[model samples]
Target: MSEDAIQAAARALSAGRLVILPTETVYGLAADAGNPEAVAAIFEAKGRPRFNPLIAHVATAAAAERLAVFDDAARALAQAFWPGPLTIVAPARADGGVCDLARAGLDSVAVRVPGHPVARAVLAAFAGPVVAPSANRSGRPSPTTFADALEETGPSAAAALDGGPCDVGVESTVVSVLDGRIALLRPGAVTRDQIEALVGPLPADQDGAGEGHRSPGRLTLHYAPEAPVRINAQGASDGEILLGFGPGVGDPRWTLSATGDLREAATNLFRLLREADREHPVGIAVSPVPMLELGEAINDRLRRAAGFVG
Candidate 1:
């Protein structure tokens, strides 16, 4: 991407306007984290619930430390996973620049140091924290390509930066470390094994409708496609569009990973869903994916897309 595009986007955020930004995970509708009006624009544009909160993206982990108070575990995870698909949720500093709306009126904040070159360039140029939620309309499939992003909510943005297709097709893995304990809030490109290896065992996160304010990806019916979805599907039901895993699992055009690679499957998940939804099929069916490694993150998105998450 050109420096001009990045600078234009940076300027828009500085002016409390919206910008559509590319990240390693997916396209995001970004705003200045310190600007409540800009942050409110994101909710209005995406039709996202105010209580869902948003993640503050920074250029570096050191920059992130200025806003969120990270304990030992949070710091270790940040060191190991920053510049990649991992978000650390922790206690907010008294002077953290993130606005109350971005934190959903909570005392905690979710922050990520994205790995995408274009996103990093914009963050560095902006020289401040910005909150970026998925660019698509709330509860819709996330946009993996610039075209899809523009189609979803581009009109609401003052500027946009295209970084081609996202390397990690899913959002960041989110973990919260508070009061000397750790819990997994959301699963994404970062696998559990990778985090557990660095931070030891993690406990299950306890949350309900009232607690949705603590995280963005906790809702059960998020990431939905236009058509209904059936998981562990043996084959496409009559008129159903099939998305299968592994070689020869189903039509090659709809396959997640022809070689059975979980990483490839994760990268293709959202794109396939978007493609299938366009065909106006009776429904979407997905073959059973093993709950291993990146599979957990893949299944997490699938379950949410199918409205089975809780």
Candidate 2:
């Protein structure tokens, strides 16, 4: 942490003020999790719905234990993904001591230990839980940089942690362990296959599709760009195209990139989206990416960007 960042975070948490902090996924609008007023300020700042809830960020597993009661499964997942992009929903341990508003009236609360040094620094300095989520308006793209946070949450949001660019550039994978079996509430940096390998086969949702109270990212029409987007097949002709995992044989207006490499595509996805959004074409078209390790998350974002379809 920079000296300025530590000072700013300390001051803000001390004063019960909200601060925008960086994480492995994206910057988050952070406030004292123990302070209801400060946590309320975060909702006001981000225009986030009280129904959506916020994730409490702690510096260490010991720190997280204070916020929620973890079972053995929860503990294992925490051990595997702490200091990384994964949030587990477990029963809150406060017994009404901590603010229930941060948990959205739910018995369980979402919590994680972010992989960013600045985030850890702030948590370490405050020596308390910080409730935060992506530092953007409720349904907008999550900001991966301090500049983007400033744009979304305004300049006076205290300090913006300069932790360079985010590695994942998306929200954390969320799993709910309050129930008997491990259930994936959201797909993110941690894939479903990875989870299955660790545990047994994931409990199948009998509803056949994940939605409503079941899964988080199952919401249609999410992670959308400001403009319309389209998806095209490989080597297929599309108007004003942006190839996701291959070369473009058409006009220069169509941006071209590789389809096989998920990491390269993930790194460039948002930047390309921003560029295409600025170009303001009738519609932005993306070619299909190959299905692989990180490809699931990449394709999920792409599907959302392209209005949840091909």
lDDT of 1 by residue, 1-310 (tens): 8888888999999999999999999999999999999999999999999988899999999899999998888888988888899998889998999999999989999999999999999999999999999999999989999999999999999998889999989988888888786777787878777878898876554342233357787678888899999998999989999998987998999999999999899889989999999999999999999989888888888888899773
Candidate 1, residue 170: Cα displacement in angstroms equals: 0.3
Query: Over 4 Å off in model 2, which ranges?
Result: 96-98, 204-219, 232-243, 247-259, 306-310
Cα lDDT, model 2, residue 119: 87
Using all chains and alpha carbons, the TM-scores for the candidates as numbered come to 0.97, 0.86
| Residue 72 local lDDT, model 1 | 84
lDDT of 1 at 99: 95
Residue pair clashes in candidate 1: none
What is the overall TM-score of model 1 with all chains considered together?
0.97
The lowest-lDDT stretch of 10 consecutive residues in candidate 1 is 204-213
Tens-digit lDDT string for candidate 2 (25-105) = 878888888788888888788666677677888999887888888888888888888889888877788562457778777
